[model samples]
Each structure stands twice: as C-alpha cells, then as structure tokens.
Target chain A: MWQLYQFPLCPFSRKVRLLLGEKGIGYEPVRESPWLRRDEFLDLNPTGQVPVMVDTDRGVALIDSTVICEFFEETVDKAAMLNGTAVDRAEIRRLVVWFDSNFFRDITAPLLEERMIKRLVHRTAPDARALRDAMKAAVGHLDYIDYLLDHRTWLAGPTMSLADLAAAAQISIADYLGGIDWKSHEQAKRWYVGMKSRPSFRPLLSERMDGIPPPSDYDKLDD
Target chain B: MWQLYQFPLCPFSRKVRLLLGEKGIGYEPVRESPWLRRDEFLDLNPTGQVPVMVDTDRGVALIDSTVICEFFEETVDKAAMLNGTAVDRAEIRRLVVWFDSNFFRDITAPLLEERMIKRLVHRTAPDARALRDAMKAAVGHLDYIDYLLDHRTWLAGPTMSLADLAAAAQISIADYLGGIDWKSHEQAKRWYVGMKSRPSFRPLLSERMDGIPPPSDYDKLDD
Candidate 1:
C-alpha cells in the first residue's frame, strides 16, 4: 500500500493523486495542510511539502511530484504512461516543468494566494497590487496555454501524460476559485473539458472546499 | 554528434555540459545569449531557453536541463554515469530537482541577478536588502546541502551521480560571481574542491567571459 500525504487543493499533490488513480494504484490519502506543519508530516518529508509518497511495500518515501510520477511510471505494470520515444519523454518532461514553474507562479499562485489562501488563513489577505499583478500574469499564462493547445491535441503530445495532469490540477483549482475565463480561450477550454472528464480526474472535480464553490461546469465533466 | 545550445555561465546549461563530459559524449557547443534569440533557436525551443540539446543521430531536440540529463542517462552507457537502481535513480532525480529549485532560486539567482546581470546588462544593482535576503536563503540552502553531504559521501548515494554535477555547476557559477562564502561551509567547500579537479570540469573552469574576471581561486580546482 502507498501512503500519500496531500493537500486537496495543492496542484502538485493533485497531480500525483491523478497519476495513482490512472494507474489503478490504491493508496491511503493523509490529509495535510502544508502551512500548518504536523510532526508526523515533517517526519514523512523533512522538506515539509506534499504530496510525499510513502511506498509501504518498499518502505521508501519519495518527495517531489515529478519524481513520484516518474517512479509510478517505472514501477506500475500498466502500459507506460510516458508516451513515444526518448524525445517524446523529453517533451513531456519539459511541459511538466513549464506547468510547474510558469503556470504555477503566473496563474495558480496568484489565484490561490489572492482568492483562496487569503480567505482561508485568518492573517493572510490579498494584496490589492499583488492581486492585480496576479490577474495580469494569469492572463498571460492562459494566452500561452491557448497557443500551445491550438496546435496539439494534448499539452505535450497526442497521448495524455503527467504533463496534462499537472496543468489540469492547476486549472481545476483555478476553476474552483472562479479564476478562469474559459469563454475567451476556445482551444484551452476544449482541452480542459476533455481533461476534466477523465475517470482519473473525477476525484478532483468532486473535491469541494469548506466555503469555496467551483464554477457551474465543475461537476459537468463533459462540459 | 550532439549539439548543445548553451551559454558558459548558465548553471542549467553547465549541468548538461558536465553530464555529457562525464559520460564521455562528444557534442558541439553552440553559444547563445538568452537575450538575443535567433530564429533558428526559437524554432528549436519556443521558450527560447538555453541548454537545448539537438540529438543529431536521433533527429530530436531535448530541452530543460533535467530532462536532457535523463535523456543521456537512458540513451548512453549506464555505467559511465548516473549509477544505481530504479529507486536510486529516483533519488538522484529528486536531488537534481532540489538543486534546480531550492539552490538556484535562493543562491545562484540572487548572486547572478545582483552581481553579474546588473553589471553585464547595465541594470541597477540588486538592493542591499534583497542581497541580504538572498544570502539568508543561501545559508539555509547550504545548511541543507551540508547535512546531506555529512550523512552520505555523495549526494543521493555513495556513488557520485548527476546530483553532484548539478550542484557543482550551480556552485561553480556562484563561486565565479563571488556569491559563495566557502569558509562558512567546510564540508561543502571540500567536496566542491574535489569536484572542480575532475578532468570533466576543466572546460568549465577554463571558460572565460569576454570582460569578466573570476575570483582569485576560480581556477584552483583544489581550493
């Protein structure tokens, strides 16, 4: 059995969860709030981040979402999740990094920091200037996503990999916060709609925060 | 023959170069400035990032330093570099990500952005407050690296792996920019001195920027 320490809304954690589900690997989800450090969580990951995967079978704990995903791809018996040849793998990895770096900072961080974290944490509130800057950055990121999706069926290549999951996790959270302006980006909207419908993504779509409600189409996976 | 698009000073590019050299792979280095994006370079990588590798034999291009490293690990002789099993490989990959994320941002970026980029691009110097903040961050990062080194002879495991190369690449550049305070970190300094002495590192140490003079100990591989 695998034990996964995760935050429901953390894009990185969600990406790992989605991969596990896709591979039909059962794991125990230990709910963790990264901001509030628990001793047990710290023991699992001294770095104090999630989703940290503890493979009880191997008695090994793995940190970093990309590393966890790569581990699963290697250990799992299902068809290789990484598509194509070495070149294709490189492309997927590049997109994965891109989503983690650019999208996470420009789009997800701003939306969550401004609209979600501020509301959840008592002492944290959205800075007016930061919020505006985040909005501008998010728009720029979305524009880039739109451009990427315009040419390819998937974010990296034809088949879905961790790259799609990484992007979807962030977009899903942004959607939960009512952060996406989907109507303006047809290709990205179409790709996301397909992504949301995957069985692996159902858990993410069904996740509801205490006070935050997702947009109307959140549950309509086929939308 | 492989073709590497890189700048000598870029840590990410340097990581790839070190990996290639360690593996004894022959590749031509095509120098590029991140600021001056040529059409050919843009065609290779829309992101216009350095450290892009064109694999002539395979007719494909690999981007992202970590991804490129993985490509070489999988394609080249496994014995020459990147040792260990599946779990060990994952551990090495995780450390590479750590160096790329934690060390790069906290230490290398501040030093380069402040000490090098400012002067090279004629931009205003980084504020003292920001540099101090970065130094604090670097100290925290160095402490973590020191702890890792203390427990294991080499990062990730007993055998030297790409993790060492990654760290060396970043630290070497930091040393050139006068960012590292080596006296404060004895173990790190000792490990780096040995790394710098390897024949694979000679090209890196010998590299000279047109107008910049590295610190006194820059060429002292055993310093």
Candidate 2:
C-alpha cells in the first residue's frame, strides 16, 4: 500500500497526482495543510511540505514531488513518464524544472497567494501591485508555451511526458484563479485542451475549493 | 568537447560546476551574463538562464543545472554523485531540492541580491527589510544543516552526493557574500570545511569577481 500526503490545490501536489494517474498507480490520498505546521506532518517531513509519498510496502518515505516522480520513473518502467534517449530525457527534465521553478516563481506563486492563500489564511486582501506584476509575467510565459506548442505536439516532444504534466499542473492552479487567458494563445490552448481531455487530468479538473469558485470554462475540454 | 555557459556567482551554475568536477568530467567554461539576455545565449535557452551545457561531441545542449546534473548521472558513471539505492537517492534528491528551492528562496537569494548582485547590476542599495528576513532564515537553515551533519558522515549518506554539492553551492555563495556566521554553527562549518577541502571545490574558491571580493577565509581549507 502506498499513501500520499498532499494539499488539494498545490501545483506540486497536483503534478504528483497527475503522474500517478498516468502511471496507473493507486494510492490513498491524505490531505495535508502545511501552513498549520502540525507536529506529525513535520515529523514525516521536516520541511513541512506536502506531496510526501510513503511506500508502505517498500518501507520508505519520499518527499519532493519531482524526486518522487523520478523514483517512479527509475523503479517502474511499465508506464514511463520519462521515456527516451538521454537527450530526450534531459529535455523533459529541463521543462519540468522550468515549470516547477521558473513558471511557478513568475506566475503561479503571486497569483495563488493573492487570490487564494490570503483569503484562507486571514491575510489582508490581495495586493493589487503584486497581481499586476504577476499578470504581466504570466503573459510572457503563456506566449512561450504557445511558441513551444507551435513546434512540438507536446511541450518537450511528440509524446506525453512529465513536462506536460508539470506545466499543466502549474497552469491549472493559475487557471483556477482565472489567471490564464487561453484565447490569447491558441496553440497552447489547444495543447491544454488535449491535456484536459485525458483521464489522468480528470480528477484535478473536478477539484473544487470553497470560497473561491473557478470560472465556468475552467474545466472545459475545449478552449 | 563540452562547454558550460555559466555565471561565476550564480548558485545554480556553481552547483553544476561542482557536480561536473566531482564526476571527473572536464568542460570548457563559457562565462554568460544572463541578465544581458544576449541573443545568442537566449537562442540556446529561451529562459535566458546561465549554466547551459553544450556537448560538442554529442551535438546537444542542455539547460537547468539540476537537469544537467541529472543528465550526467544518467549518461556518465565515472564518479556517481547519486550513489545509493532508490530510497537513498530520494533522500539525496529531497535535500538537493530543499537547498536549491527552499534554502535559496529564504536565505541565499536575498543575501546575494543585497550584498553582491546589487553592486554588480547597479541596483539600489540592499533592502534592509529583505536582509533582516534573510538573516533570520539563514539561522534556521544553518541549524538544520548542523542537525543533519550530527547524524550523517555526509549530507545524504557516508558517500558524498549531489545533496552536498547543491547545499554547498548555495552556501558558498552566501559565504562569498559574508552572510554565513560560521562560528554560530560549528558542525555545519565543519561539514562545509570538508566540502571546501575537496579538489572539486578548488576552482570555485579561486574564482574572483570584479568588484565583489570574497571574505579572507572564503578559500581557507582549515578553520
């Protein structure tokens, strides 16, 4: 039996969930609120971050979504998310880092913090200046994604990959906050529409957060 | 021949440089100013980030330091930086992510921005508020490093791994900026001293930036 501790709306957690689904791995999901800093959660992961996977059968615990995903890639080759030659794998990993780090830093972090976490955590209303900056940053990223999709069927290559999952996961959070302007980037929108129709992404699309409802077209399969 | 485009003071770049040295692979160094967003450099990496690796022999280019390091781990086996079983590798990777993301976000980024990048980029004087927060965050990280060192010979296990390289790369930048209070955390200092003494780390210690001089003890092997 495997158990995954995760937050419902965390992009990192969503990335892991999507990967697990794609791999056809079944695990019990445990929702964790890292902001609470619960002792037990901290005990499991000193960092107090979610998306911690406990492989009960293996008698091991893994933290960091990317690391956990890589572990799966290494151990289970049945449904490989990182399939390819060394260069191809590097391409996938590069985009994974880009979405998880650069994209998250520039777009997801500020928008999510302002739109969601602030309200949940009793912080003051979202900062307008921060939102403006995030909005500007997001356009560039969306345009880049459009450019990439123009050349390749998927983000990194022709096949589905962790890169697609990662980008979708991060962008999904921004989408839930109504940050993504899908119409502006048709190619990227088409790529995302393809991702949205996949069975692996179904669960994430159906997730609902109280007090912050997603836009009507948020979960739609078509742009 | 391999050529690595890097910035001398970038933590991610240093991480790659350290991993390459540890792996016993030689590559020509190409200094890149990512901030300049040179057309040629941006052509290789749309992100305009430093630490892009070009393998002339293989006719491939790779970006993202972690991605590059992972590529080396996959393709080269000379000095295994990811040495261990699956579980062990997960632990090492978790720490690498911790240092690269959490540690960098909390401590190293602010300190470097204030103490070093400000002068290099001609930004305004360091923001006092940011520096204060970074100082407080540094203490928590230093304590964590001390705790980890107390239990293990090396940061993920008895053998040196990318975990140490990543942590050291980030910390070395902090040290260069004179942000590390070595006297406050003896065990971490001792561990860092071990890392610094390695032949792999020699090149980084000798690297000199134009205006920002490292502390006198920056390159010292022994305390």
Q: How close is each model in CA RMSD to the real structure?
A: 2.5, 2.1
Q: Model-by-model lDDT, in order? A: 0.81, 0.88
Residue-by-residue lDDT tens digits, candidate 2, B65-103: 888999999999988989888889999999999999899
Q: Mind giving the per-residue lDDT tens digits that candidate 1 earns over B102-173?
A: 788778888877776776786676678767777777677677778989899987789898889988898888
Query: Candidate 2: where is the Cα deviation over 4 Å?
Result: A56-59, A128-136, B127-133
Question: For all the models shown, what interface RMSD does each have?
Answer: 1.3, 1.0
Q: Per-residue CA lDDT of candidate 2, range A113-140, in tens? A: 8988898896679989998888788789
- Where is model 1 chain A poorest over a 10-residue stretch in terms of lDDT? A130-139
List DockQ, one per candidate, in order: 0.66, 0.76
- Docking quality category of candidate 1 according to DockQ thresholds: medium
DockQ of 2: 0.76
